[model samples]
Target: MTGHVVWHGRRVAFRRGESLASALMAAGVHNLGQAATGQARGVFCGIGQCQNCLVRVGDRLTEACLLICEDGLIADPDAGGRDG
Candidate 1:
């Protein structure tokens, strides 16, 4: 469960049992977060209040903190400020 997720064609380590948000941050994607107001954010309220670290999992919107990543999880990191 340790392959990689392409970031701008750059292969980034993808842990099978880690949070996508955490992985993205580790991969230097901490500033890539889409907020409801169309602003930048990233797990502001790590507990889940801000809804900042939202991402897509197989076409479904799921919280990075609430979801455990798995192998082959094609994570489309949402940078800038846009909805997933």
Candidate 2:
């Protein structure tokens, strides 16, 4: 079995070792993270290049495009939360 992601308290399907961005997309989440524009903002530059797809992994923040998904992970959006 892959894994599951908690989006806004909603349990979503995900695969282990897969990037958060891909998982979000599989879950039909376009707005990976909120941007200066609004909640409908998303970006490219996958991997560890850009910090566009930022999300909260547990108590820490991480790039959704790069960080690999794990089983039972609580992920949340955080575009306005951190600038890193």
Candidate 3:
């Protein structure tokens, strides 16, 4: 099944088994957020190892590559900020 998630307040569609990173990338959202040094961040390793695809899901930080896309899910790309 396919559905949409709230990505940075924008709706991004995804398949049921798709990861958050994959969904965001398909929507042309490459720049997930800025690092502490103001460098742009995105999915690097494509796995949960690099910590580059960090996104705020609810009140916790999680790897976008590891998070399965869910309908109506709210993901804050910029929520990582300096602490990411």
The models' CA-based lDDT, in order, is 0.63, 0.74, 0.86
Evaluated against the true structure, the overall lDDT of model 3 is: 0.86
TM-score-sorted candidate list, best first: 3, 2, 1
Candidate 1 lDDT tens digits, 1-84: 476655334466767776767777788887645555667766767665667776655555667776665655665556434444
Q: Which has the greatest lDDT?
A: 3
Q: Residue 60's C-alpha lDDT in candidate 2?
A: 83
TM-score of each: 0.66, 0.78, 0.90
- Give the lDDT of residue 54 in candidate 3: 84
lDDT of 3 by residue, 1-84 (tens): 489999878999999899999999998999887777778889999979999988888877899999998899998865346543
The parts of candidate 1 lying over 4 Å away from their true place are: 6-10, 77-84
Which RMSD values do the candidates have, in order?
Answer: 3.3, 3.0, 2.1
Pairs in steric clash, model 2:
none
TM-score of 3: 0.90
Residues 1-84 of candidate 2 have per-residue lDDT tens digits of 476878768777876677778888887887866776665444478766777777777678788887777777788777666553
Preferred candidate (TM-score higher): 2 or 3? 3
- Give me candidate 2's TM-score against the actual structure: 0.78
